[model samples]
Target chain A: MSQKRKLLVHIDALYRSALYLTKNENSADDLVQETYLKAFKSLQDDKEIRNVKAWLFRILMNTFINKYRKDKREPSLVDFDSVEAFHESIQEEVVAPSILDGESVLETLVDDDIKMALKALPDDFRMVILLSTVEGFSYKEISKIVNCPVGTVMSRIYRGRKMLKEKLAGYAQKYGFK
Target chain B: MNCNDVRKYLYAFLDDELDVEKNIEVLGHSNICCGCGRRMEKERLLQKRVRETVCEVKAPAYLEQMILKRTEEKPNFFISVVKKLMSERRLVSLAGIAAAIIMTVYFFAIPGNLKKDDFLYLAESKYHDYMMMPQLDLDIRSQDQEVIVEYLRKQTNSSIVLPEIRDNAKLIGAAMSEINGVKVSQVFYMHDGTPVSLMIICKPDSGSEDSKNVDFSGMKEILVDEKVVYYDDKGFCGHCKIMGWKEFGNEYVVVSKLNSDEMIKILKKA
Candidate 1:
């Protein structure tokens, strides 16, 4: 098979991320299509891509930031300085002990609830969390994908997970999940 | 590490992003400390849940087919035209002598079921084919703008002005071509070491057949220099962005790897 066809192995991963980012199936389809078009174009240049998955993800994120973000008017109002400060605050803040506890919250929580909570996150936080937690990209890999420092990626992932857990906990309360 | 320090490193540890020493320290602390150990499990579960939730979403069955279809290399139109022509016995014998005549008749006479808006797309395809050539075969090759303009005017028998690109791109040459049986002039330039083509196709006369008409009404319109210029930022065919506008009954299209904004700026400066 062609290299472009081989890249399809990551389609599920890319589409999931695209769906969450766009919050619409049609837009996600367009975004993924645009990503593959760009990838194919780059492949034509004969430049060797070392990590195809990470490279594809980078193109997806960049396209999202450039085209979709502007179209949706999703502003990056939270600057890196504030994000760093938020990380510092997270360090000092007391950890809310055991929201999940021994309870298998994942089993009780429906996919929509989890998806809704994740979708509600600010674009930056949602991006890092999706990259780090959901897609399992390493901190360094996410740093390159999102074009930010490793520290920034870590901060966003930390804060993003915290917010997601809190939201999930709220859902559990509403649904009477132990 | 204290409880606070261990909490800080918890995510990195779960993500396997920490160094070996830091990993051991976090692991050792979590092993002995009940609070840290429980927090570790909870966080791990959260990560797993998040991954599992999103991972359940597979791309739709049709998405793969759509992507493959869209990314598939478009067939070379010129080759298809030649194949169709070569399939006929009489055309094969006169192919060498009737190349230009075949082009004129194919574009103007046949109508070929092409939509009115296809005029621009056809021009874009011609530009794509030209760029694919191993070397440019320009009727007139010169860096002098007036010389190229004069050559096009003489070839097409129409006054034409080359749009002044604000960039350091130099006029390389000019070629005379026909689109939809309407005579057109193609001006070539080298911008930042990349070739750019500017095609000018004059609207056919009012008495001209309906098949020869070109349409720009459906394209996204922008006013540059107070003239309504339509642009297609989403490139046509290959990677070439196409921008066209009508002036004094002549349609101007600039096709290049340069983006829409830069192309617009060029039109504005013109």
Candidate 2:
């Protein structure tokens, strides 16, 4: 993809990542904006970043950590109860089920199913995986974004995927996967 | 490879994160484990399904407006930092200049111990919780009877240390209080229930003669819960008696309780 198109994709994806990190809309907006500012300045450097999307996500995630997580010393705000409820509610049928087949679910997919999956995963695991997978972040990039060892990034991804698959299984059994 | 290994590496392979060797091992295991193969396929489908379910959210229309406004104001943050650094540099230079001026003036300065004459002034301006003890009860612990006799001898000098107070008082018996530490002592006298305590200190600079309270006032007033003003002048370095009712190394409190009218009279005369 062209750099400009890629930057737009990155911007949208990082916004989702930030939203998942800080459940609050205002906070997510700020985190992603800060990510853009930093990414703009840092992109001026000569280092090679293999995946700009992942690189953007990592910067966004770290910015959230340094700005909000450390300052508040609390897990991201979560209401798993509501997440499960929303997922169950969506089982009646997606507002736009056909949107689920698109390469990037940017069209008209209900944000509820995604929100439900995100809420079920623990905050630390949820943020790391959402940021890495959706953004196609490499382990090294994720390690920097999450401010952890590459091993830790791998462990979290592994565990996060496991938890997500389990939740999806439950969703399938309880609500049936579309 | 067992079903467990198949399950573990299956996700890794789908993520395109497994090396070729691990992919070979996982593919081998999955071919033998029917359940693992089905599960691995479902997991891949689920990964795709999740990405498809999550729609990207864009910044609201106002986000652009906010960024543009903030950008114009952006240089202020860096400019403030530079301003702070420049001011700090100037302050350091000014302080260095002041120190040099002080050093030059020190040699010409009068014996600082003589400055004790201003004590009454600094003490009045300083924060003294005189309310902590409104009554004065003094006792003397002087081994030298001659010192008490001589200090009291001021009564015979016909010079009223506080002349206005002379109408209601003469130098009564010079009493002393328990000397606790460092030649710490209090000379006491009563002008009709108005008390006067002189906290005598044997400072490092001994040659200094008896100075009045007004001389103490000339020194800068340090606002503190209780200040420890270090006076280094005239070859003398002694803490200006802490001006407030504060617990210092010890309570070298010059205990005095003069009523409002009596205090006014004494201060007026002094």
Candidate 3:
């Protein structure tokens, strides 16, 4: 495929992720524009990128992180030890999954409810969920884009999904869904 | 697989990330365990809901077009030229030499017959030379505008009015110089410790060859107080903004490394 054609194909995905990251339409537009510009300029270097979509996502995430989160430390890959510890804690709790039997409740939730739940997520968790669930990136691909380890990616996905279910549970009950 | 094992691989199973053997084991366990199966279904439903909601946001119709337009607009000309030159190193170097020789011949051979406005080019060159020479000194080294103006007036034998730029700049000195055999008065000022030079000479008559050669072609023009002033877009002398305007039957030119906005402010004040 032509370079531009390949790149432009992912604009919708990039824009959606940008909106999730920025939470403002104008800033999302700016972020996506900057991401494309950076990607195009780097393409001139003639480096062969194996996965252009992942590469573009990497650029978008880097731009968003650098431009907006300059003051904060970068979210690194979840350490293996931490992931193990987190998993152990969850196993110990054995808390009943709030989302069990909530399938019909989830179905009742509209797009706006889902968006509000996603937006309510913390930045770190939201990024992973958006990449995995929304854009369908693999844990390995998410690792590369978010510059974290696969273990960290899995942990974020688990926690992020758990958080989403809890938030949706409130909406599910309010909407009269058993 | 027991409930603990099912719980451990539940997320990986939903994500389709488990190995074939592990995937079958998880499926088997979930089938026998109603609770684990229900939990897996809930997670699947949640993922579907989130994906469907997020997917509702397609890029606005204009976003792709805007991005493509931006890419089209930002052509890296210098990089492309460099790439081409690198690929054709031998031929490009030979062509470069020939082009340089042709330009040199064109400049030197046509100077004698060149029109008066051509003198502006010569004046710009002279301006560069004087500005570069460290030994060249002003005739009057005074901060007082009156002293510098009086000195330049007597030296050039022309009526001179020193511009008021006291708020931001101070007078450095004044001098007399000749450009294309025409006497010119030069005043210098210091703005934030940087030197700016202003050159003044009689406005050439409509039919004069000097006036014809002085029109700076290709420079941008803007009217300040109804007087047309021309300034070089890429900066003229030593990266200084050179602005010229004709006022009171005299042509005034100011050259400084100060930015265009500041230069305009000083010129408008003048």
Candidate 4:
């Protein structure tokens, strides 16, 4: 396959993440287009990219942060410091051992519910979550992609998943699903 | 492991991030503990739901077409060549020599027959080139004034002094070449997000044939700090302003999109 064709293979994954990050289809489309342009230029230089998916994602995330982030009306609700603060207080609010012992109502929570929950998250948390839970990038790969330490990536994933579950549980309860 | 310890590494265990020893420990504990096992299962189910929800989104068919079309467009030939050559340091001198020959032919082919407007055109063209691709042609990319001046002096074999323009402008870099045996240096700067070029040309000699080869008698002259300065507010090319002045027998020209007054206000510091 041509270099461009090989990159297009991951367009679905990139686009999906872009859609969730920007929360706008037009911005997602623009972001993906810009990413491909940069990737094509780099490929022309004959640089060897071992993992094209991760490389493409790094470009996408950097471009979003540098350019698109300027238009963001609100900053990431949670930063590394705040997330660390929450980590310190994790022991204070004891996570009951039996809190999630019963069957999950996640199946009853539809796609929209899941998306809204993801969107409601702070940009930082949602980024790590999408990269991990959806894209299946390892903690190491995600740390490289997001340009953060592995421990930070780990903390974000843990907190993000917990928050997502709470939002989904709220949605399920409103839907009268136990 | 106690419930708190198991929960601490629960997500890591579920994500397969834990090492073998830790993974086995979490697995062993959850196997015997009903609550922990159910919790792991619940977390797993939630992750699956999130994956299903997000992965359902596919790149629109048109997006692929749009990206392919855009990426397929060829980059500017000059820019690509310069960018490629910059990566290989050995070829840089050869590239510089070739570029000087090309520029010499461009500006000095009919030097004796040239008019004042031709100088303006040259200044405008060089300024546009520097602004469009600032990094590629620069021989020395430095913000330090002394560094750039020293490099230009060595390369052109001429004494070069850069005017300290204190208008929030930054000295980006400089490129030097011996055009038609006359040393020339182009210094680039950025002020208020706009690029400005300072072209410094070494005078051949007093009444030398090479000195009379290029004519500048037709340009509009003004006195700045008691020194005669040549300027063209009505630029030969587009709306860019071109100003030329003699300092210590060397020719200095300024070209930018700025108006004559704005250019003068900044050039007054020279």
Candidate 5:
């Protein structure tokens, strides 16, 4: 692939993965930017990489784990200050009252709740569930990305969803988020 | 099909992550079970909301443009630090792999050079140890040993006769032992000429022969095959297993001088 095309693919994949990981608009943009910088500097073996999307995802997940999980290890939501700020920032941009159905309204109700819920999950769980559910990666693909056993991937996705549902039950029921 | 398992995969289940058969099962279950169907519907709505909010309209336009510009720049110091860290990690992984190979060679590979006597002795000890306990079945402790013994006598035609063993073999008559927690009959046969002792142990607890250790003095080395001592329910192997485990309190241990196979043949005769 040409550098331009590769860049585009990298950009698109980063955008999607960053969004999934951060669950907030502004922070996702920051994450994607950070991922590319890191990916390029360590760009020794990406040519041999088949699934660029998953590879980028692994980077994003690792970045999240390194940057986010460590900070939140004490289960202190107070440490979630920056990401929460970005969420608030994104909310400001999307507050036009906008159309009801066409992603705008969709953006308003469950999007904020969903992102918070996803970000609220434990690091390992948040990544696995998003990659499998939102990104539609296979168990095998996820195993490669996360570099865990397939059984472990399945377990994380299962338990992660269970935990997410439980945490989101009230919000899901009240807002009709889905 | 259980509710717990269904709820576990409701999102992926709705997304068609499961194979077709399972998907169909989920759908069928959902249709019949209102709870599951609604949960599936709820998941569908959730995904739609997520994609709409996160992917399409979530991020700001200025952030996208800013990200595009910043994505290309790599600071030299950061790159060098990352490179150093990665190399160190690689070295650590290599060290781990080398250690694992050494331990594996020390343990499993060491067994290859063992002499036949060593193998026989190991096999005998292993077999005796395995047959003595109920490893697999948890509910075999209460099973009637007599029923299994009768089955064995009929199947092998008493080919595993114990009372009339040969001069070359020592008979360690019927005892109680468990295979997988199931109790069954048991018998022990050891040949004096060779060091091999064949133990007849029942599986799933053969109830009659629950795990009991026996020591019949002066037979030199006793080699038991732990793997084979297990019940092979197809024919009379179970009988061997049961008889091997079917001894009572400490009393009736009719020892003889016949070999192990001869003892099994005698049990078949009964």
Candidate 6:
């Protein structure tokens, strides 16, 4: 397949992520365009990209951070030690035997509700959650994409999901599922 | 693995990132422990819901084609050689040969003219007519006037001053375009939900023949900041009113559907 044809397979994925990142259609379109253009240009340098999807995502993310989000306040960084401590603390929470009762609440909540909950997350957590839960990127892949350690990725994903669940808690309660 | 151990690695296990031994231990523990099992199930459900919700966003139909067209191979050396032959006075005989060949295939091969009005029409069509340009894209997108002006200045090798408009107008972005075969900068803004485009072109050398033809014959000239600013209330195109001025060796043209007074107010504020 041609380079462009090969790269085209990931456009939908990239576009979806760009939309979540930008929250505007035109900006998302521009972001994806820049990503693909940069990807194609880099491919000319004969760099072999082992995982094209992850590679494209990394470019999309870097472009977004450097160009689009330059003026926006950056998400505060969490130190590795603090994240590890937080993970340890979360594990000590009483394991509710009835957590499964909330499983059906996810079904009751529509796509928009889930989207709003996701958007409510901080940029750092939201990015990791999207990469891990939605795109199914490995913690290591996400670490490389976000330029952080694997431990940070793991912590962010855990915290991101926790935040998402908290945001949806009211909806879950509305449906009497939790 | 005990419940506490499994809980610590719960997300990693659910994400399938745990090592084989730990993965097997977590699976075994979750199967036997009811609470751990429920927590795993809840995590799985959350992941599924998040994925399904976000997967609904698909690229618009035109996006792929736009990407492909934008990355299409630019003019190669042969076209550059022909362009050079056309430009250099010393290559007059060669230019004659190239022009003849160009004319024969011009209808099908050459892109649209790189003239000043062509660029203006492009800006007008994109903002007003909602058209797309295969080649044109913003080099920088920012609401900050300073950022947009700085970026355009670098691209055009000329300083750019963004006009101040009333009613809290915001800068959208800026792009570099060719005007009269010279690189010029175009800045886009939005006011009351309407788009305004400002095209900045450096004035040609003082004695150049092109400078003599800079005509605003039908446009009404007015003084703003002691500059001879020109305005056309009856738009140059059917839908767009145009205001222009020359300062600091650059010609600035502001185009929009905005009335002459509003456009002039913006220029005066600059």
Best by lDDT: 1
Q: lDDT per residue, candidate 1, A1-178, as tens digits? A: 8887889889999999999988899999999999999998899999989999999999999999889867765454233223323334454456445346646665687878889999988777888888888888898899799875565566567777877887888888777765
- Candidate 4 has a DockQ of 0.20
- The Cα error of candidate 3 at residue B53, in Å, is 0.8
Q: What is the lDDT, from 0 to 100, of the residue B94 in candidate 6? A: 81
Model 5 ranges with Cα > 4 A deviation:
A10-13, A19-30, A41-46, A68-110, A172-178, B1-5, B8-12, B31-34, B57-270
User: Candidate 6 DockQ category?
Assistant: incorrect
The parts of candidate 4 lying over 4 Å away from their true place are A77-84, A96-104, B74-270
Docking class of 3: incorrect
Tens-place lDDT per residue, model 3, A80-152, is 2222233444565366657436546666777888898888876778898999888888889998898755665
Docking class of 1: incorrect
Q: List TM-score per model, in order.
A: 0.55, 0.47, 0.53, 0.56, 0.44, 0.54
Error of 2 at A100 (Å): 18
Q: Give the TM-score of candidate 6.
A: 0.54
Give the docking tier of candidate 4.
incorrect
Indicate the worst ten consecutive residues by lDDT in candidate 1 chain A. A77-86
Report model 1's TM-score to 2 decimal places.
0.55
DockQ: the better of candidates 4 and 6: 4
Query: Which scores better on DockQ, 1 or 5?
Result: 1
Which portions of model 6 show Cα errors greater than 4 Å?
A: A75-85, A88-92, A95-103, A176-178, B73-270
- The clash count of every prediction, one per candidate, is 0, 17, 5, 0, 79, 0
Candidates 2 and 4, the one with greater lDDT:
4
Give each model's whole-structure lDDT.
Answer: 0.68, 0.48, 0.65, 0.67, 0.48, 0.66
* Tens-place lDDT digits, model 2, residues B74-122: 5678888866766886878877888888876753453232233334222
> Candidate 3 — which residues are off by over 4 angstroms?
A71-85, A176-178, B74-270
Instruction: Using lDDT as the measure, name the better of candidate 1 and candidate 5.
Output: 1
